[model samples]
Target: MVAGTSTALGWLLVLLFSAVAWYLSGQRRAGNKRGKLPPGPTPLPLVGNLFHLDPREMHRSLEKLSKTYGPVYTIHLGSLPCVVLCGYQAVKEALVDQGDDFSDRGAFPVFYRFTQGNGIAFSNGEKWKVLRRFALHTLKNFGMGRSSLEPRIQEEAQCLAQEFQGKKGVPFNPIDLVCRAVSNVICVLVFGKRYDYEDADFLLLLDHFNENFRIMSSRWGELYNIFPRLMDFVPGPHHRIFHNFEKLRQFITEHVRRHQKHLDRNNPQDYIDHFLLRMEQEKQDPQSYFHMDTLVMSTHNLFFGGTETTSTTLRYGFLILMKYPEVAARVQQEIDRVVGPGRPPCLADRKAMPYTDAVVYEIQRFISILPMGLPRAVIRDTPFRGFLLPKGTNVIPLLSSVLSDPTRFKDPASFNPANFLDKEDAFQGNDAFVPFAPGKRICLGASLARMEIFLFLTTILQQFTLQPLVPPAEIDLTPLCTGLGNVPRPYEFRVLPR
Candidate 1:
């Protein structure tokens, strides 16, 4: 019986080796068919270059690899080979110069599993184009970036400030407050109304969103993206991501259903109303992208996109201000001079408040949120820098490298507003300051996000000064984790009346 068991184990070992050999030979043949590609560390049979990467610090790991392989190189995530574009020039050349060719969304299994190629973010081709255009139009119609939306944001900011005042100078983590305030802005557009800050259901939904964003930015999420099929059978926090998504999905679907019942094609109230109208218009068209599934996914895209990054930025920005009191003071001085606490900061005040504008821009650059940016893919076979990328090859544009490139910024390591200030102390924009990324597929809510960040942050400062629990020098700006997002370390602070 022992001899038989040994014989069976020997046969299993032989099969494993045979599979590896077959995969390698197949890779060789494919390499011959595809033209020259950038060289990088050799990958193993099935795992590819997974070992070479530090899953926790994906952006830094990719940057380190760029040191040896130059700006553009190829690294495999499992069997999938993604071309990495590091530094500003390479990234700009590919994402900007050859925008159309590399305009497609790459395979992001984690999000795709939930979205199923239905939303604007994960979907590709004409479906993406249609949904994106429709969503943008709907958001604009609902006053997304225009002056009309200012009242909604200003009202929300005032609510946020009053909420802080209610804290009575007690120390507290501002995550939920900031998230709710930021989310309410999108809530107005998507759901047609905002929620009370203490609303249990709304708070629960925010909790799930926060948890999902944290987990999706964890090592488990990175591993899932690389080896999704394998990670499915394995257990970890990554599973929570999908579970949280289902909760959000159910919430959005219920809202969608409510809108469907009160559908008025003439007077569409919000995003859901607009989408239901579109679905009715396209009901007869079999090829139409408008459907119940797409509406839910698209609404999820706008709601999630609107909330997460902007709130995270505010949370991180507040921490930075606490760390550098002098910078915060300077911003407050600018605010006092311009807005003078008479009203909330407006977009029109931006040009006059150069220092505050510089500070805001600097904060975005310093954190480098979405460090690796979203993955991209080539729509068709394209040649980049004498190397041909196949029709569907995945691409990673390292935005962190661009933001922190020595060639681009004088001192990329430190957090200095001077990086964005010119000789005359005027606000200067940099080509590399693309926190929203640049291309046809740039974030749909980029303009609105800019407005919210500026208004909400300035409003908070206008009402109170952020007092850190620890000394300014002792405050650490290091992120808690870095994956899809650079999550700032958690801390509690008191807001003294300004």
Candidate 2:
């Protein structure tokens, strides 16, 4: 109780001091305009441009800002100057061509508070290098991009198909269904096992994940990132983000503890087991990055990232399919020809099914999940697009700019698979199709995610004809909310067995 009270007092002080800082910050923004930085709107004191940005849709706000200020511009988040990199040129120059210098994860208050730089997604410098390298090596050994792990995905795909089939042409929301399938895949990799779909405990855990995504993408999450100390003093659903993560952390810690009791160094069954083995090996090194906190956080990272993204992607993809029945028909036709009822779809089938592959790419492109993309910080004082970005400045690689760039994608505003196809109708890919931002900080599980999305999508589409309860014309494609992520509004659809 004392600790809670003390924590509350600390936040109150932070809020009070921050209010003064916010006021002074507004005065500083006018000076920033002439400071030789990229041109942007003059921010108000203390609040900076906080009120200028729409909390419900930051990507849209950032995208709109880019229109006036040019691709490379700066916006102040509170007193901090965040450089916004819009369009393909700005994003690529920073994230890809200048990858290493811009590789460090920019500090977002919510993730910083949650991760504390302990895991792959939010860590930086040598710590990020070590965790990322080890994770890649371990993932490779576990058959991330290789053919060896295809069967595991195929198995889950089959399970998902069965679950959908069991719904018996009745209307149901696919969010929870796909979340379970996706999260359980990470469970297999992290815990060395899968959860029973009907297990009461597993269902409860999934509820937490479902809520976390909703809250994290909601306005509450955005406000937390902007005014953390202030929000820390107050109470709202933003607090639920931490509560949910705590539950997830507790769950991960319990698994880690359980694994510690009977871990086999010689026969590492999963990511945790492998990490445990690595920790033991690095025990003698004082600067070792492999430790229990890293394990717990990284484990949580995989489970959190591994689930929400791909699951939400698939969920949104299906929603799109339901919206465009003709597109769905074309994909089904391609899938039926390449992968018949006799066999399930595999990664290899991706090559054989051009139309279906295009649909998958288009889904990712249209939705543009992580619309603003993950934030990156300048590693050092750097020259970029004719401007000097000082070290430690937070950067926004506006992926929405790339994915929806009118110059790159012919019909950027529309959902058309041909954007990823050609006149010859072969499966094609575009550099602008960077749903996973490129560079040193590119998604660690990109391959795994790709495999799951393709396999799960094909598996389900192959078996069932997804139809919205309402006519496709009536379906709304606009996201319900979009701050850090684009969350599709809830809708109902039915699965008719093919």
Candidate 3:
């Protein structure tokens, strides 16, 4: 009896010790996790603030969170430590002062799968460097700022004018028309020509592109990026997005192949021709990143970036004009004074139309297409505001804060062009108007985007005055979606002939 009791006691002690050890180990792990991270909202185990987040209005949610946690706050989305930077001062410090250390774009699995780490938008390191340099050089050569591209833009603008004329003062959805005009600009640059609006292939491509953009900003996109391994098993929008990406890839590849077949060494026409000729020149150099995959992805990036941003801005511009008719009238008046009906408005006319210029600036500031300004990663250990940000830390600069900061713009929430103009009614540029972003990773298409916005706005305003189709009480300019970009709710408007 004594021996049996002793043995039982020994076994109980061993089990007790094992339990204690396991408990201590878990405590140590929790402590380590806390130490590694900056102070943030307490999260549940495993999920880590996933349920607390609303992926659609993430910017608004983060803004509220910033108010509680101060300008710089950290949050965990699953295992990812997302550091949100609010206000202009914090954003400028990280993005501009420490550009090199913060230049790396955080690679999400879904984006990686889509882009395959090939394009300038998503790719990092030496590959991005080479492609970006080449893109800027090539774009400049193809008349990005020069007058050579003006005729092409004017051609597209004329088509737009014709479409508006066909509407004949009736209500119409300008989304498709605007998209076609913007897409043609990219098409001319990439494929060297424009497509007819009724062309079957062109329509299909546009639909596919639009669908892809929508899906990318949906809830499924957030889930797929957060838990890619698990989401891969599900059948839904994620699956469709993947299929669309593949289709786009194939389409771009075929175009690249055709360009290769018709390559001219001396006389290159369009982006593909230029790329193909360059590829041959760099064939002997093993370090050359110029190849079929990169070329296709770059072309795809240009198409996606060029079309979506410009079109969305124009869409918002019309919506804003409808919301504020007096503002629209002023813009039309400016257009009439600066650009007569017989002559098309040139870029030089922007200087003369101060109110028109201020309105465009206000639209960019108010809409803020890319609110988050793309996700950037710290390439090296850096100090931001006396805090140590380790290498690979995800830094998201909230550009909306800068544009909408009351300190910077009086009555930031309202759409007032006076925010950009002086008492003399002259155009006054502000350093805080950073819609296209700034520094090393600033938008490659800044000049092109500016030109497009100015030209498109002046052209449309010169021809028609946009007004709401519904009652003033029914019109809502509140954003309906936030993903790859912030898009306004769908609304109809009549374009009355000026």
Best by TM-score: 1
TM-score to true structure, per model? 0.94, 0.93, 0.90
Top-lDDT candidate index: 1
Q: Rate the local accuracy (lDDT) of all candidates.
A: 0.89, 0.85, 0.79
Tens digit of per-residue lDDT, candidate 2, span 375-469: 89878877887887777778888898899999899879999999988999998889898888988888888899999999999999889999888
Clash count for each candidate, listed in order shown: 0, 5, 0
Q: Rank candidates, TM-score, best first.
A: 1, 2, 3
lDDT of 1 by residue, 1-498 (tens): 999999679545534543554454443213325656788889876667876888889999999999999999999887678899999999899999999999999888899999999988989999998999888988999999999999889999999999999999999999999999999999999999999999998998999999988988888889888767656766788999999899999999999989988887788899999888888888999999999889889989888999999999999999999999999999999999999967778889999999999999989999988998999988988999989988888889899999999998989999999989899999988999989987877999999999999999899999899999999999989889889999999999999997
lDDT of 3 at 81: 74
Error of 3 at 463 (Å): 1.0
TM-score result, candidate 1: 0.94
Candidate 3 local lDDT, 395-463, one digit each (tens): 778888888877789798899999989999999998788888866788888788888888888888888
Query: Which residue pairs overlap in candidate 3's backbone?
Result: none
